[model samples]
Target: MVEPLPHVREIPPYVPGKPPPARPGLTSYKLSSNENPYPPLPGVLAAAEQAVASMNRYPDMGCALLYDALAAKLGVQVDQLAAGTGSVALIYHLLSAYCGPGDEVVHAWRSFEAYPIAVTAAGAAGVKVPVTADGRHDLDAMAAAITERTKVVLVCTPNNPTGPALTHAEVATFVAAVPAHVVVVVDEAYLEFVRMADPVDGLALVRDHANVVLLRTFSKAYGLAGLRVGYAVAAPEIAGALRAVALPFGVSSVAQAAAVASLAAEDELLARVDGLVAERARMVAGITAAGWWVPEPQGNFVWLGVGDRAAELAAAAGDVGLALRPFAGEGVRVSVGEAEATDRLLHLLGSLEPPS
Candidate 1:
């Protein structure tokens, strides 16, 4: 039997949020993945369906229409954008382009699970900086963790699984502190859901600093998770490098068409995002009113730092026909799903003792 590289052998597999199990007499909701509960808009769905008619033909390698739509929407040059199967894939591409064996990638732990996976896959060492007790990234600590070997630094605003988002001033100051040679990646997969004051202007960061890259996805807000459309905005030089390493025709024609249609109907799609934001507020309020302390959530999910009770709470949710993501010995991440799901979760939490 052939053996894989030692680095690949040691890499931990990514665990995605699971779907709810079937129940005999109850409705089940999958709130484990931080996904948009709403279905795609009629226009977006139609665009995807139309694209499906040409299934025999290969997709455009350059993703021309998608790039055009994105450039117009973001006010960025076409050469400065690189699209991929998902933002997660783009992460891998950027890391592969910049990092080699012994190079370091600094990121907040308990943040996006993909960071370490992608970092390790690029044959780079991951410098895991622990997040704050409030589930926010310790930007100062992250900056201090940087070394001469550091090549890439990731900042996940409204971080996944965790709930807190970094403020503009906070990230801007941190960016200024880092050396100019290191690449700063602002992973804004949850940007559309953020409702906080002084949110980080990722595009501005990219404009001001050639080393900064902004990663955005259509999955969370545009209800395009299944389509797997995401893009990165960077200086043309970095963007070109990412594009160079990207998988050929990684994004399918259907996905491109759906993404373009979604952009054209951004107003309607964002309205759905507004609904999820309101639902997130409701979940936070209910949890707080019940005397439970959770990090202030700005994304479409809430973090319950239940420590050892994480698995226990997740099991209870599963028993009630709801699925939630849990990190053993840490906490459970509950995505703000349908109203019924939120109500069911609140009822379950109210019945149990809050985590100490």
Candidate 2:
């Protein structure tokens, strides 16, 4: 007999950014993953180095120091916060905690690629609501889609691939309308880049609403993607549920140290985020000026509806020494890199030929 669950065969594996080339030649820019172009700040590096010296010891399974630091910074109680390897792990833990066969998890189409994957892995059905033409989540549509089976609603603001962030009013309405039994997760991976007026204040929701959970990541603004540390702020009960589902010591010792030190260097990190915002604007302006259909990119990347020419354009960009993430048959995502990477992308765009 086949000694495994039959459903596992039908599951598609998650695909991250395309792997870098073997040799370090001038062929890849890795504008696919929305990682910060900056390196870990000085304080974070120092912390990591100190932790490295103690690698022989297992990390603090409780992540006590990191938890205290996060609580102080976010103005939450220690019981209200839980850390993970990254917010992605938190997402998975959330699903495992609350979703099972016959349960449903809701998310927007074309948002984070991992949402549906995590839902399916947990043996739950994924209900993907379509976004508006402007690419913002149609909260009402999502609310309408919910039924008794709905266990969680995942909302990503300044949504990935597409750019518009849901205003505070919009998110509040959605949260209010969703069924009381459903947990609403505001995945604010890119929240630090957003300077939008009336931004979605997830922390406030977590404090006031028992069903709300705020997932934030150090991978984005703090420039620690490689180390992998992120957290969720929720009601104490909900946080406990998440903790129950998470593996012990899931976060590395070095990751914890770096995350705590990074918190101390918030100003420096925000300055880098500010630079990225400026660079995002530049990427948008250049792409739009080229007459390509670029989305209103609010994140650290730009999405182009390049249609059938997407692969051709990506190839051209690669030939001229730029790497881009191609998706579907019509879309290409270009992460905002440093000045040199951005310059190369603009130059490559200028040299590309129209679809034949």
Candidate 3:
């Protein structure tokens, strides 16, 4: 009989949002995952196709061209950047690099579900600081919770599940208070979708704080989710440490080509993000008018804090053939999808008589 480690036994597996089935109906649209409802840009697709032709040869292990491109785009030294299969993978790498038994990683509870899983996987204790009642990070509480054992602090602006984002001033205050030795990762997967005034810029924080790292992804705004590519920008030493633990050739040639192309076509891609931002605003305004009090969402998703009624809300959504992300006993998260999908969800939501 095999005995798994005690920490391994305590870890909960990460659960992804339900996938939409291929049902032929208007109500069957999937709003479960916070995925962009658009396809890859034409130039990006062409680049990916071109790379596929070279499948016979191995991808560049050093990712030299990608480094150069990112450096030129970001105006940072090439040594300050590191690429991974996904931002999720980069998170895991960060955990593995800095955490071990007896160490602790701090992050907001009910934030990204991956945080706890990755922390436990690294044999570290997860210190979950609960968010404020309005679904924003309780920064002061988090700063107070920090101890000598804390190795990392994860701040997810435009946080998942519940969509309130940290303002630039809010983030600045938190970073200034954190210890210099502790790594602070600002996960900006949904950064491009943010429309708030004075939004936190992770890149700016990274430039100012030696221990700060910015985790950005192609999966969200760039619409390269299928290709699985993300990157981190940090001090050269931290970037080197991350690269040290990363799996070799994890960023495939195809993914690299697609990412470079996406960067080249970023202006047009961001215009599509503007459309999603509008859709999110529509969802919020439409639902608020229906008497529901939702936290103002800055990401491409909306949160319904149904509390213990989570399962019921999810089931009701399912009845309409709408797949929503529901956190049982907590709340529901519905993404802004295609126009028809948005119409169906908003119509269903508006028809309900809930407390303001």
Question: What is the alpha-carbon lDDT for the whole of candidate 3?
Answer: 0.89
Candidate 2 off by > 4 Å: 20-28, 353-356
Q: For residues 1-356, what per-residue lDDT tens digits would candidate 2 score against the true structure?
A: 75655545545687687754333557456787898978777778999999999999999988999999988888889999889999999999999999998899999988888898888888898999987776778888898999999999999987987777888988988898887779999999989888777999998887667899999999989999999999999999889999998998789999999999999999989998999999988887876666555656667888776767777877777675677887767568888888878888887776665333
Q: What overall lDDT goes with each candidate model?
A: 0.93, 0.85, 0.89
Please name the candidate that would achieve the greatest TM-score relative to the true structure.
Answer: 1
lDDT tens digits, residues 151-260, model 1? 99999999888889999999999999999999999999999999889999999999999999999999999889998989999999999999999999899999999999
Across 1-356, the per-residue lDDT of candidate 3 in tens digits comes to 99998899988988788876455554487788788889888899999999999999999988888888889998899899999998999999999999999999999988999999999999999999998888988999999989999999999988998999999999999999999999999999999999879998777898899999999999989988888899999999999999999999999999999999998998999999999999888888888887787887988899899888887877777777788998988899999888877777778877776743
Q: Can you rank all candidates by lDDT, best first?
A: 1, 3, 2
Worst 10 residues of 2 by lDDT: 19-28
| Worst 10 contiguous positions by lDDT, candidate 1 | 17-26
Q: What is the TM-score of each candidate against the true structure?
A: 0.99, 0.95, 0.97
